[model samples]
Structure formats: structure tokens, C-alpha cells
Target: MLKIISNQDFDTFAQNAKDAPRKRSHHNLHEQLDAGVQRLFISTEPETYMRPHRHSEEHKWELFLVLKGQLDLLIFDDEGNVTERHSLSPETNRAIEIPPGTWHGYACMQSGTVGLEIKEGAYIPTPQEDFAPWSPAEGEDGANDYRDWMSTAQPNTK
Candidate 1:
């Protein structure tokens, strides 16, 4: 069967994200967690906190494409210093391909922001070591501050 994603789907996703405690939600297109390739539509509100982390598995490169609203993609050095930033929106730079082992995260820049994420996977959870040691984990103290800094951080400035 063919699955269709429509504007109403996005609207519902946005609403779900808004209502969720984490301020984010995803609709998986892949039927199983062990699928060789994983694809999903993610909806995020501005307050969503995605801590900087990287996929250490050799085959885990990830791609993100903005379907609506905007997001700031932040690339970090091993020391957790900002190395690069890209603004992605439907009207402009809409997609990013992140190589495996590259430290990165996203900051939602608009309400109702939705994007498509694709990655290689057997859906292994990110090992704790893969999370940036210099960054706070989700819901930890200073996470909000780190997120605020990520919103406007620039390369070489931090």
C-alpha cells in the first residue's frame, strides 16, 4: 500500500509536538525499527532541545530536509565548539546530509517546523559516549542555556 503525507498530516504533527512535553514528535515512514533504512517526518517546536551528538556507526550518515518552517543546523567540533551553522527552510537551503561521526544538532527556528529525516539504521540507541561530553543531556541543568546559545552561535565565535 502507498502512504500519502498531506498538509493536514503536518498540521496534526505540529499539534502533537506542541502538546508533547518534549516539544517534538515524529511520524515514522519505515514500518520497523530494524529496517535497513529509516525515514521519518519530524515536527519540532522552538523549545525542543536536541543535544549535540554523533552517529559513530560507520553506516549511520543522516539526511534532513525541511518540509515547513525553519531550523538551524549546528556543527560542532570534538571539543563542542561551534564549527559551522546552516539555516534550513523550505524556501532556501532545505536539506543537509551529515556524515557519520560528525557532531551536530538542530535548533527549531519556527513554530510548526517539520522536516524529513533519513538515515541508515537498525535503530540502535546512541551510546552515551556518542553524546557530547561538553554538552548537557536532555533535561539536565544548563541544557536550556546550551540550547539558547546554539540558536545564534557562529563558527569561531564560541
Candidate 2:
């Protein structure tokens, strides 16, 4: 079977994200395709907190593309220091390629924000070595603190 994803597809995903408990939703476009590489669209609201994590395995690489709305992508160093933060929107700085073994996270900056995520897959759980120990897990109080900083964080400021 052939699957074609259009703007309407993303619209529905974004709508679902609004009411999603985790403040986000995903529409997989990879199942019908090959297994090694996975592609999907993730829709999120401003409240979403994407915990900082990295792929310790050398083969794993992550890519993000803003399909609509806005996002603040934050990159951290090995010791959990803020190294880079970039504001991205569909009209500008739409795509980012994250290398393996890099700690990173993002915050949705708009009501209905949708982004395309692509990576090497077989869908393994997050390893303890890969997940950042300094950052709070999803839904934790500290996570909200991170989210708040994300809302106001600039490119090079604290």
C-alpha cells in the first residue's frame, strides 16, 4: 500500500495534540516503509516538555524539522550545561540535525506546533547512559522549571 501525507494529515495530528495528556501527539509515517530508518510527525502544545536526552549509541542520529508553528531547541553539554539554544519556525531555521551522543531537548512555543522527527530506529528504550541524569523526567516539578526557562531562553543567554 502507498501512503501519502498531506497538510491535512498534519492538521489532524496538531488538533489531537491539543487535548493529549502529555501535550503532544505523533503520526508515524514509517511503518509502511523500511525498518532501519523511521520517520514521523510530532505535534505538541506550548506546555510540552521534551526531556533532554542523547543517543549514546554511535549509529543513532536524530533530525527535526518544524512543520508548523514555533519551537525552541536546546542543546546541552555532557555536564548538563546549556551549550546552544535556537528558536525555530517553519519560515526560518526549520531543520536541525542532531548528532548521536548529544544531549538535547525542545519546547513548543505555539498553541499548535508540529514537527517532523526522523531517526535510526528499531525503537529501543532509553538507556540510562543516554538519558540525562541532571534533568527532570517528564511531568516532574523540575520539568516545568525547564519549560519556563525554555519559554524565555534566548540564543546565548542564561
In candidate 2, stretches whose alpha carbon ends up further than 4 angstroms from where it belongs are 32-34, 155-158
Model 2 lDDT per residue over 1-158, tens place? 79888888878998899889988998888775547888888999988888889988898899999979998888887777788988789778999999998888898889889889999987787877777888888877788897788677654444
Residue 13 alpha-carbon offset, candidate 1, angstroms: 0.5
Task: Give Cα-based local distance difference scores for all models.
Answer: 0.94, 0.84
Model 1 lDDT, residue 136, Cα:
95
Judge candidate 2 at residue 107 and give its lDDT. Answer: 81
lDDT by residue (1-158, candidate 1, tens digit) is 99999999999999999999999999999999999999999999999999999999888999999999999999999988899999999888999999999999999999999999999977889999999999999999999999888998999756
TM-score of each: 0.98, 0.91
Q: Per model, state how many residue pairs clash.
A: 0, 0
Q: Tell me which residue pairs clash in candidate 2.
A: none
